[model samples]
Target chain A: MILKNKDVLGLEELSAEEILGVLEIASRFRAVFDRPVRSVPIMRGRTVVNFFHEPSTRTRISFELAEKRLSADIVNFSTATSSFSKGETLRDTAENLAAMKIDMLIIRHSSPGAAHYLAKVLECSVINAGDGAHEHPTQGLLDIMTMQQRFGDLRGKKVTIIGDIAHSRVARSNIWGLNKLGAEVTLCGPPTMVPGGLARLGVNIEFDLKKAVAGADVLNVLRIQLERHSSKSFPSNREYHRMYGITEDVVRTLKPEAIVMHPGPMNRDVEISSEVADGPRQVILDQVANGVAVRMALIYLLSGGDPGALGVGQD
Target chain B: MEWSWQRIPSEFLVTGVKLCRQGKLGKRKGFLHVRKGRIEGLGIGTPTVEGIPALDGDGLVCGPGFVDLHAHFREPGHEEKETVATGSRAAAAGGYTSVVTMPNTDPAIDNTGMIRYLIDRGKEAGLCRIHPTGAVSPGRDGQGMTEFGDMVNAGAVGFTDDGSPIASGGLMSNALKYADVLGVPIITHAEDRSIVGKGCMHSGYWSARLGMAGMARAGEDAAVFRDIELAKAAGAHLHVAHVSTKGAVEIIRRAKNEGLRVTAEATPHHFSLDHSRCRDYSPLFKVNPPLREPDDVNAVADGLADGTLDCIATDHAPHTVTEKEHQFDQAPFGVVGLETALGVGITYLVNTGVMDMGQLVQCMSETPARIFNLPGGRLEEGAEADFVLFDPACQWVVDADGFQSRSRNSAYLGETLTGRVSATFRGGRLTWRDGG
Candidate 1:
């Protein structure tokens, strides 16, 4: 199965078979990560531009590293360094990049519909990095890949995404991916931060941190994103940590062998303790490594490239 | 005391004689002086009327201008929908001397700065007195409360999370308590999320028949019930917004009978129309706390007549043409109300003899001011001169194109109405004059 060269704007557009095909390709790429010669010439001549209007070091670096590993020419355009400072509109910048013959454009903007807008306007295949606290599809795919690599299969495995969910694009996208893979995903956060109607999305929601993370096969901790905090959300970061943080002591409360993961640049000492990020049960580094392979799979799948030789796609 | 008699034409005399010192000179006769536009003088005996424009008093009656407890002047962001100036002009032409604007704008009025900005804009318009309601939550997000004390200090007449229900019980209770401390009311757009599941119109035969999602009456009733209990717990006041259900009316009636500090308001659409009007799948009939059944409309009218309902609020939500032109469920919920409220009230309530003109004035003016604790609701001697001159019998067809509101989404367009405003005065100045 191959994805049409259109926008992967949301998870709702993907069929179960298409998602499995992407995952299969990601699994093959995951195996390549262990070898000494890990680079692939999948998108050798393709120019991938990482255009991030929002701040995220980990996501940007992951995409850059993923493109480099795929041998694609990459240009990282941070909002700070771009013509956005010169009052260039998002459409103008995207058109400029498209005119430069960029084959695949990965965009992250602070507005919710920014990616969809770019996808509609630009001729190249557009991948959404993150859009204002909405779905982060690539991060979600990477998370599922991490889980699938560790557990062999995710059918009926329990995964808990813990922390500020209302503002986490990661949790939303992960919920879509995890549920598609037949994982029981529980979203836990302070009531103010966790979105209502998660049950409508076929996910369990809990306010009690201990109960939410208990007996989970995987725990994905989301950062508290201090800049997104309005006055109404919480009294203080210390208070938030006291109630909801995934500290080492809190990790001890989880299923003993459950892997702990954080979409990094973690708010260590706030949302997740540094001890857990470096602990024996932690696969946070594996997530970073798998990030490239998963993104490469997405880029190849969406760019009309075949992973058939690796036995990833049926046709 | 001595007295003199004079005769004048029927149309120009706008006065109501309040008896002073009964049995003096046979009857308690007082003359009201109207000079230019302001009330120049009033005398009890030997009418010493000077160079003031005095008109005849024959079969006409006069009262203070009406005020609306709710309106939406969708300006600043969606001006293609409604502007403050046009909305205020519409209010004035609808016999409204003042209107309380809901705070669900593009950027919600969650702070004193936004409140001041709206007030300044209203002032610049120089029409009806625009008293803005501040949002109870930041951006009306419903997670927590905005600075109620600060909003109150900045002259927000009331607080509400209109266009969105405050889903959290804790937040609603806290807001009520905060408003209680500040001696203000937290007006609620009472619709429970659990019951209102993306509904477009009132749940009834029409909704089931048309296959459109229906906003159940349970939605409004459930929230009204919950908020009443929460208000009791917090010992605070909760004003139900756009009360459209009989069940909600019953709850508000019982709460008021229990001596709870509670008030409820109904929109003109609720008492004048029902769900059957939505059979055409018209977007104008779509409203949050949607138009209920005919029985509910009657119950609402009864509630208003018997003092169960405190005021008639015009939930005057305005949407752009593009926003309202979608399919029934997809289009926004609301229709323009500020300009149509008085005509609807007169045509439905007054003409039907269900409620007299005095009761209509009470609901639209006196009671709204009393409920919100505003100052200008009376036509007394020293009171600020805010009044409306309306032809009580003039019938006109509603036309959106001819409306002063920026948005042309009134559900009542083409509906025949019995009364129309001839002029409006705010603070003794003629702010709006029809056919001027």
Candidate 2:
């Protein structure tokens, strides 16, 4: 089935079937990576613009590589390089881009609803790379894809997200996507960093880090956003590491088959230790690998490519 | 330009209208006899006096014109959004005859001269009575106090640092004490800036789900708590502005029960809308004290019904379209409410059975007038003929384009409302008529 939406703003708006459909397509795209000629002509002639109002490294390159592999023409705009620095409003820039008749506009803004705002103004498809602490839909899908690769079925899986759940858009998107896929989601963080209101979203909030990771099927660790001004929530890096950090001791509390995940760039020893970063059961790199496929699937589907018809011509 | 307070002497009889007055709706259709600029007589039935032009009110409900205790007439500064003239026109269109404008202007209305300038501008417009509020601090900087006595003498009805909270407790206590001496309410914007730092919307499930920074309800609550204690210590009237959280309502309710001079006002948007309205990321919904959860909406509505909230103030803030067009986080914190306040009251309160029309009118008109101790909330013999005619059942959609205010940044834009104001009159002269 083709994706019904003109924009992939967030995972919160998508249905379970729609999410699985994108993941299914992503699995097929994931296989294409093994081939010598990984490039596909699915998005041929379509122009995609990567508009990063905020700084990024992994999500941008992953999307760029996804666009290249899908054969879509790509143009990149970062805050330092774009006319945005010249005091052009997002609407003004979006209007100019719409004037150029681009196919899809991928935005990464520091504001929460920046992507949603542009999607309403532009006739073209819009993908949210990361909007404030809101959602990173493709990242969510990639994380979900990585989990499904390990456990196959997420139903009844205890996925514990530990860190600044209050400010993590990755945690939000994952909560929505994982809850839709019937995963039992538990949030673990310091009291100040974990908002109890999220419990209304049908997730359990656990303040104790050990109790949160205990017998968990998957542990998705979030980075301590020292830059996002969340430093006031906890005392220091040493205190946070001592209290909630995912060290080897914390990882050993999990079930033998349970895996650990972190949406990078990890704060090294702050949120997760180096031993756990390079340790077994941590699928951090696999998450990065799946990100391209997930983004490629979304771009292909939102570009009106048929999900059922993938690999038919190229195979 | 020449400005005159004197209106053309007029004689008219408003007949066949349901009159709402003194916390009750008249059982029989009545007629109001207006001579010169005051109500000559008003009672149930036809007037004995003849030779006066008679206006057919039809099935419309006539009540004392609404008095807004809070509005931002962006004048002497941000004229691109709203001037005193345009804001007064909007007030008249919304069936308001008197509006208390907030002091958070370009230069901040902290001085006596600025207060007089706004009153003169209102008279120049010849639409509504404009009562300017003085800022608590000279620049609303939450620092030292403004000269309350001089500002009040210059026709300032109240004092507030409304766009931003009076962050310091000592300064707030001093402002309240000084305002008490001047017999004016110190209107607080009621937010703890430290708690609400960078939060664009209500801190709750939606903020968590949307991934935006949440403005915790504790901010408003803690600020209200502090302000109420300060008012108690100062023996002053603390009028809480835009009381959004249930915690704020409870605090105010307890303070009122203890008989501290605390009067509070809730906005139409706060009572009717919720944080879910921000789901679209529309800056229109990005109000300060941000549209709260449904429970808070119910609490506000209940607070108004039970008199914990003393009045319904529009907090009629206006911003330019381009300014509001920015992303939600970057957009200004307010929605234009001058034109939509009455309709929202009727639609959300009266029609929903939360309160009857008389109570709603009392909240909008009489209580607001009493809260700030303003004139013209009563329709009685030998009083200035400041009143409004509105059809309680008239269903129409709100169009911001049709607003008389310079800006179209209304939260109720495109909403279907059950009431429509037909006409407004101040000082026996027609200020606004439906089709005109």
Candidate 3:
């Protein structure tokens, strides 16, 4: 039931067993990343390019780290340094990259359907790192992996993603992943920011973040994108953070053992306070570590590599 | 220059002495010349007026054409829906000499730059004069006010957040204060969000029977009530846009009676149709300020008749076929009104014995011009010659495929309508003429 070598373009394409298979493979790869000898030869002699058109130090580095750990040669193609300045079409750029014998492309673009466009045009396997506030599949997978590692299973877990749901790729991706993993996800933010009918996606929704975060097994905080602020989506960053931020006081209301997580380059004080982000119950760093392993698993699984060959002894 | 005194055509002889000056003429005897496309003169007999064609104006009312106070010419950003050129042509065909375009585009017209862009693009199209409305809030976010003075200075005729209601009262009040200072009207699309959440069709037995979400009348009334109070508090000119419900009509009626500087507009659909039309779950029947009960339609008709409703504005919301071809709740609200408005007005108001043609002209032409401070709604000389020549007896079917708008989103498609516009003139220039 593993994903055959096709474009992992959207969550709609995945069956329940395929999703479970990805998670199981990701869990095994997570154990491999913790070992002293972290690198593998699963994708040896193959190249994976991280073509991130948007600004992201974390997702890019995590994918690069994952590719390097899987013994795949890594090339970073940032929009700042790329031929995007020369007005090369995205299709042309992707074709040029694929022409270099690149086996896979990990793409992040600032448009919702950018990655899907590349996937359609190129012969190489395309993994969407992020696509314009749409979905970040690896981040969602790693989040599920982190939750599974902490709780032994994601089944029946109450997971809350609080803040900027309207502009969060993380939220969209996580909703799909968590729903598939049998976790009851709750989305909480300002009513304007929290999309309507998320309950239709099998998720609970709340505007009051304080009430939403309580009794949750995982409190995943999403970053409020500043560009969205310029569009007047929110009144102000300070005002948004005041009402919905994961403060030390707010965290106190959660189950004592419940973990707080953020996909970082943390707007540490804006979304989650320094105290809570760096707190004992915080899995912020573990999520980052799990990101590389989960991505390694994604690349390995999608490229026809056997999941059991990773040496974690799969069921 | 040659002047000729001719004891000429009897029609001219009876009207005046046949004294002909260069280019000073009327009909066949008097001469009217266009020198480099500018009107040189209009009185004398001259045969040397080369390349200046003349039409015999026997019984035709020749003056500056018509102007529309409200038109949703979706363009610049969402051309898949409609463009300025197509919309302008539609306006011209409808006998509109000028159109005050709504500000609810993709990158909503909230700033001076977007406003300038709209003006520039409209001018380049050269079909009719397009005066853009500035959004009340920046990007119509409803959180803060846009620079009203900047937009006003940029030749914005009015201010509105037409697609969505201004959700915040404080911000709306502040916007009104700015409008008060500038002496511009704040046109509000009054729908309180709390009562209207995700409901597509109008609230009534039809919605309940169809198992569809019903948009309540309170959604519009609550906000209209709030805006009327806010307008009174600020003493600002408030224009209620597309007033739909009986409750809203009563409130606006009271406000006008109290001598509040408040005016309201009812769209053609509001006066013509009611919630019963939505019983089949037709998305075409869907609109914002969702079509209310028959009593509401009756109230709107009374308002239009009694002058409580100041004008009949076509909230001509155009959408692409793909955008409209969805389930009742999922499809976008609004139907194309520019092409169907006059016919609907004729059928529902004029034919029903509720109003005469003069009253229709007063509401549709005179009042909107006075409220928005635009010229050319009147047919007087020296004013922009803006007027629509309608047959008043011609009947035609509403055909979406034949419309000039880029989108086929008209709710009235296939429905037969009365009163067709025969010709439209703008600044004494023929912009549209029905086939001879």
Candidate closest to the true structure, highest lDDT: 2
Backbone clash pairs for candidate 1 read B8-B56
Deviation from truth (RMSD, Å), model 1: 13.0
Off-target runs (Cα >4 Å) in candidate 1 are A1-315, B1-48, B55-60
| DockQ in order | 0.01, 0.58, 0.01
Rank the models by lDDT, top first.
Answer: 2, 1, 3
Q: For candidate 2, write residues A231-257 as lDDT tens digits.
A: 388889899999999999888777999
Q: For model 3, how does the per-residue alpha-carbon lDDT over B114-140 read when each residue is reduced to its tens digit? A: 889888888887778888999988787
Angstrom error of the Cα, residue A49, model 2: value is 0.6
DockQ of 1: 0.01
TM-score of 1: 0.55
- Largest DockQ belongs to which candidate? 2
Candidate 1, residue B421: CA error in Å? 0.9
DockQ of 3: 0.01
Give the distance in Å from residue B345's predicted Cα in candidate 2 to where it truly belongs.
1.2
Query: What digit string (tens of lDDT, one per residue) describes model 3 on residues A175-287?
Result: 88888778889999887666563565678888888779878999999887775564465687688779888888988887877999898768878888889988888998888
Better of 1 and 3 by lDDT: 1
